[model samples]
Target chain A: MKVLEDRIRQEGLILSETVLKVDSFLNHQVDTELALEIGREFGRLFAGQGITKVLTIEASGIQFAMAAGIALKVPFVYAKKKKAVTQAEQMYTAPVTSFTRGETYQVSISRHYLGPDDKVLIVDDFLATGAALVGLVTIVREAGAQLAGVGCVIEKGFQEGRGLLEEMGVRVHSLARISSMAPGEVQFVDHNDPIRIKEKV
Target chain B: MKVLEDRIRQEGLILSETVLKVDSFLNHQVDTELALEIGREFGRLFAGQGITKVLTIEASGIQFAMAAGIALKVPFVYAKKKKAVTQAEQMYTAPVTSFTRGETYQVSISRHYLGPDDKVLIVDDFLATGAALVGLVTIVREAGAQLAGVGCVIEKGFQEGRGLLEEMGVRVHSLARISSMAPGEVQFVDHNDPIRIKEKV
Candidate 1:
């Protein structure tokens, strides 16, 4: 996590108080070695959960989900943002509103993939408004699968994302937790503090 | 490649003469180990090419790109299907028509990630009409990057994809080259033929 935080400090572009872009290495362009390390961190955090599957939304989250799946030696399923021509089977659906994109879209997964017999671990690239993560949680429940927890590569702790997931009794863990950020400076939640309540990998 | 061919034979659903679905293991729900193996195969094919980066389009191509990046020990970049909120910088863009979705979309990559000094090996999940792959090739050319070649997991050899790339004087290698396919049968172009002109990896 410290390594991620350091990389964020070194390469992250802070556009505004609310906008931080790590496109240089995280999402748009990726560092595969770093991604695998992040996955290993997730695997270490959820080592004994008996996770049957790793779930995520398409595009951005696919790499991280794939990484976690590789680390845990399980298959990863990414919920499609929109139904494609090849995907015509019956699906479990949930609607999500994107704060950044300023649109609402349906996230769906084939019903054939997840069911009551599965235990799921949800992963994603960023946790800000938590809309997509919440939608994924709904689909996981709808499929009658056991929710292990949520793992995020980066979390905007100042946002309401963690609060919303915590209200649903979903344990949330983030590699880089941003307590605050500005045009030039960024602050992370101190994990070394004895009073820090969040779980550490 | 044999393992991939076997997986397709066992789990692939042939919807028509032109459409074959391997969502069970390739795209939607990904088998990470198999994907890694596929990456290793690509690595074996493109070894000694000095590929500085692996590239692909977003969504489905992210996993294979990540896998190849791992195998090659370099970074990977996935072009975005649409400009996201976080991506506000200048970009190199190309238009692509999706044969499956029946629509055209622009795929863009941050200009910061790729440039004249880079050596790129493009990897993707499929090579059918070569629309997306072509778009990526254009972007790589626009960036003035050296392209080693294009690597595809599966190719519908009956289609014009290979011909189109070959016409561009670009090298292409597909792991499983399907000569033909029907509702329940799929034929691969035999690699054992001594007269085959294509490079075998």
Candidate 2:
């Protein structure tokens, strides 16, 4: 996490108080080694939880979800941002509003993939508004699957995302928790603090 | 590669003559172990090429690209499917028409990540119409980067994709090359053939 935080400090572009671009490494262009390390960290955190699957949204979260799947030796499923022509089967669906893109889209997963017999761990690249994460949680419940918890690569600690997930009784863990940021400066939540581990159901 | 071929034979759904769905382990729901193996296979094939980076388009290609990056110990970059909010800088853009979605979208990558000095290996989940791969190849060329070749997990050898790439004087390698498919059966291009080793540029 220190490495991630350091990378953020070194290369993260703070466009404004609310906008931080990690396109250089975390999201757009990726450091594969760091991604693997992040996955191993998630695996360690959720170890012994009997996770049957790792879930995430498409586009940005695929890499992290894949990494976690690699670390935990499980299959990872990505909910498509839109239904493709091939995805004609019945699906578990939810609506999510993206503040960055300024649009709401439906996210869906095939009913064939999840069931009451499975345990699911959700993972993603960033936790800001929690819009996409909340949508994924709804689909997981709709599938009658057991929710293990949520793991995130980076957390905007100042935002309402963590509060909303905790209200829903979802345990959340973020590797890098940004306390605050500005045009030229950024701060991270203290690692020694108990907030690193959110409340678990 | 035999393991991949076996998985396709066991779980692949032949939706049509052109559409073979391997979502159970390749794209939607990914088997991380198998993905790693595929990456290792790519690494073995492209060994001694001094590949400084691996490239792919977003949504599905991230896992394979990450896996190849791991096996080769290099970073990977995925072209964004759209112009993102954070991506406000200059970009290398290419327009691709998706036969599956029946729409054309522009894929873009920041100018900072790729350059003439870089040696790139492109990876993807499937090579069907070669629309997306051609777009990526164009971006790499536009960036003035040295392209080692394109590596795909599966290729519909019956399609025009391979011929198109070959016409462009670009080398390609696909782990599982399908010769044909129907509602219940599938055939692969014999791996023992020298044609499997595409003419290198």
State each model's CA lDDT, in order. 0.90, 0.88
| Per-candidate iRMSD | 0.7, 0.8
Candidate 1 is scored at a TM of: 0.94
Error of 1 at B3 (Å): 0.3
lDDT of 2 at B14: 75
If scored against the real structure, what TM-score would every candidate get? 0.94, 0.94
Q: Which candidate leads the pack in DockQ? A: 1
- For residues A1-201, what per-residue lDDT tens digits would candidate 2 score against the true structure? 888888887788777777788877888889998999999999999999899999999888998998899889999999998988777778899999986798999999988888898899999999999999999998999899999999999899999899999999999999999888766777788844322211111
Report the CA-based lDDT of candidate 1 relative to the real structure: 0.90
Output candidate 2 Cα RMSD: 6.1
Residue B153 alpha-carbon offset, candidate 1, angstroms: 0.3
Off by over 4 Å in 1: A191-201, B191-201
Model 2 global lDDT (CA atoms, 0 to 1): 0.88
> Residue by residue across B57-134, what tens digits does model 1's lDDT show?
988999999999999999999999998788888999999999889999999999999999999999999999999998
Give me the runs in candidate 2 sitting further than 4 Å from their true place.
Answer: A191-201, B191-201
RMSD of 1: 5.6
